[model samples]
Target: MSRIWIERLAVVLAVVALAGCATSKEKLLTHDDRTMLDIWNQETGGPAGSGRASRELLDARQALRRPLTDTDVQTAPGVQTRYTRTAQNEIYRQFHRLPNPDLVMYVFPHLTGTDPVPVPGYSTVFPLYQRVQYALPGERVEDY
Candidate 1:
């Protein structure tokens, strides 16, 4: 019984070892597999043949050269207004300047400490601009 068990264990170990040694035959391509030119050439009839450009592609390229008509200028009213409003709002924000005027304060000569030391008078300056405030969503701007 011990001999049979040892033989079975050895067989199992051998199978596991052999399984780890197995490798896939398929190889991964490190570079680009296929390019547009290669596909075009294949479809046209291999590398030896000249690939003719499709008519639809040539027509689309020619269409791009044509000048825009008045009909093309007229888009859907909703889309047009939305785009215009966005552009105008952006321009307004770019040119927007908040009034951050400077404020000056004068300090009078005063006494300090328990000994009462005299301090000279001096003036200090600061900007009146407070913290930046933004309007919340759905809130209307009463003043521009």
Candidate 2:
């Protein structure tokens, strides 16, 4: 009886596998796949039965073709008067710190005392300004 049950289970599994493989290979269009007319109708709030939508779109396009007037350009939401320069900002701009100049020095060969150990010649470099110092905007030329 157990052997008969095992054979029946195997046959059922094989049938299920074969059924899964029997699906059609054709591709299906999803709900999001829309035709151009569908998209146009959706965007324009439905078909322009009397061609009013097309006429309005054409009128808008033609209006865009004309050069923008000064008033139209200036009236944009992003167009605003420049903010008044704050005293702190002005001071910060005037006192902007400049990069310090570097100076390189080469030491000649020398000997140490006590044990008379010989020292080899070497070069050392250091910045001219060790601390931060601000200068007037036009006071110094930064052409280092």
Candidate 3:
């Protein structure tokens, strides 16, 4: 009887531990991960794998040219817009145009220390939201 009880408890604990290790599908992106664009083709399929190595290169170039500031982020209609206009523009101009319309742009305000004066900087990454089919062309197209 005691052995049976111990076995049940062990099984329950094992299940809990496994559950804790599981990560949601939504939370899958990691730092070293290749972008969605790199994995897909123009056909709108899953993970075709590898193309246009310089896509983010353009975005980086654009960011380097622009003054990355907190004010710039606040003034823009939204986060995505700021990236597309300022950072992405520079990237597009400097290198090949970004084919993915739904590209995600990230802007992070960081500091030297854990909590020092927030030194402003920006980064852009492709987001799944951009991949969603739009009703019409252009940003804020659904507003109409």
Candidate 4:
């Protein structure tokens, strides 16, 4: 009886370990394209081809779930009145329909004065998020 219990526990542990190892590869891939498409479609309907983009977005969103910090702004207050007029030029460069770039944060590598190291993990990429106004479902961008 004790042997049977031990075998079951061992099987469960092995399954958990395999699951963790299996997911490591997915973490390295870039799925942000889907996320961007989903947000764009949900806000503005473009074409029927965007369905795949929405699925990718859902996957990415699920993967990035984490506890929010105070500094993180889910929705920018006064996103239009404050940024729409002044950021018009900037918005034109970043997006076509909406000037707000808040859905996805752009991450770039930190520039160091030292020579670039070719080793595996010596530096990090920084996140740069552009704040954009979002509208609810079936709502127009101007409504925000």
Candidate 5:
């Protein structure tokens, strides 16, 4: 009976202690009476700081900033541009197109079907190789 009383007393004491430790929602969720601007001004020292840029500070920043001159930019001699927007460059980018020469064939006019309709002669081009071939970097792809 004494142990039971002690356990009950301990639980009651714990509940009371927890209640005292917990903050009330009203106090925790309460809005500040002072405006946000006023609080910021107090923290940043108003005229001295207050998050506004001064004319002298702006002038100093302008003095540091200057237009880039030709000498400021540097490029190595004999170094070429990596990529260019050209018909040949666009077709074969990153990998150079292998020397797959085109074979132009002329289609002689011929009669077709049971009706024997006349077809006009035309010229057609096809790569010697059925598919386009690409050469790896530093490989002999360009013609002499």
Candidate 6:
């Protein structure tokens, strides 16, 4: 067959397919004004057995259901008990600060810079580590 004839045939086939789809969609959309209850009644047999199947199904479901106790609902995953954060755990649970004891240092009296003047000493406290350390997710970190 010629290329032109093939193109015309393809266009005709497309048009026929589109027409078929439109008719089918129209038939599906055109339904009688029946309420949901009427449709449900027809599905289970007839209007005489309306709500009988629904009641039986609900009763069976209720028999399977059980009462939930206090243990059913739990707090956050890692928490065994609930309490206010006081010391190290005060920080976010994800990045817990590792224990680092504070070091007390005393600066002795010394000469002033650029001048021959005497300066009194003072005491200061700083963490043992220069930077605050954090424990990893699964690492064992003691909470006191």
Query: Against the true structure, what is each candidate's TM-score?
Result: 0.28, 0.30, 0.19, 0.20, 0.32, 0.33
Candidate 4 regions exceeding 4 Å error are 25-38, 46-144
Query: What C-alpha RMSD separates each model from the true structure?
Result: 14.5, 15.2, 24.8, 22.7, 18.0, 16.2
lDDT string, candidate 4, 65-101, tens digits:
9876765554555454444545664554323234443
**What shift in Å separates residue 56 of candidate 4 from its native position after superposition?**
26
Model 6: lDDT to the true structure: 0.75
lDDT of 5 by residue, 1-144 (tens): 999999999999999999997998889777778787788667655645323545566678999999767655544222234444568767756676777788899999999999999999999998899888877655764653
Any runs in candidate 1 off by more than 4 Å, and if so which? 1-95, 132-144
Candidate 3 lDDT by residue in tens digits, 1-144? 999999999999999999988988668855546565755543444333334545555567888896759898786767566445566566643232233444557667767886687868776766554444433223332222
Alpha carbon lDDT of residue 45, candidate 4?
Answer: 53
Error of 6 at 123 (Å): 39
Q: How many clashing residue pairs appear in each of the predictions shown? A: 0, 0, 4, 3, 0, 0
For residue 85, model 6's alpha carbon misses the true position, in angstroms, by 11
lDDT (Cα, tens digit) per residue for candidate 2, span 4-66: 999999999999999898876563434567888999898886788547787887789998897
What is the Å distance of residue 41 in model 3 from its true position? 36
Model 1 clashing residue pairs (backbone):
none
In candidate 2, position 139 carries an lDDT of 67
Model 6, C-alpha of 3: deviation from truth (Å):
1.4
Looking at model 2, which ten-residue stretch has the lowest summed lDDT? 77-86
lDDT of 6 by residue, 16-117 (tens): 999877767656777789988889778875565346776787789999999766666554433533244556556658566788899999999989878779
> Relative to the unseen true structure, what is the C-alpha lDDT of residue 45 in candidate 2, on a scale of 0 to 100?
67
Q: Name the lDDT of candidate 4.
A: 0.58
- Model number with the top lDDT: 2
Give the 10-residue window scoring lowest on summed lDDT in candidate 1: 133-142
Candidate ranking (TM-score, best to worst): 6, 5, 2, 1, 4, 3
Q: Which ten residues in a row have the lowest lDDT in candidate 5?
A: 75-84
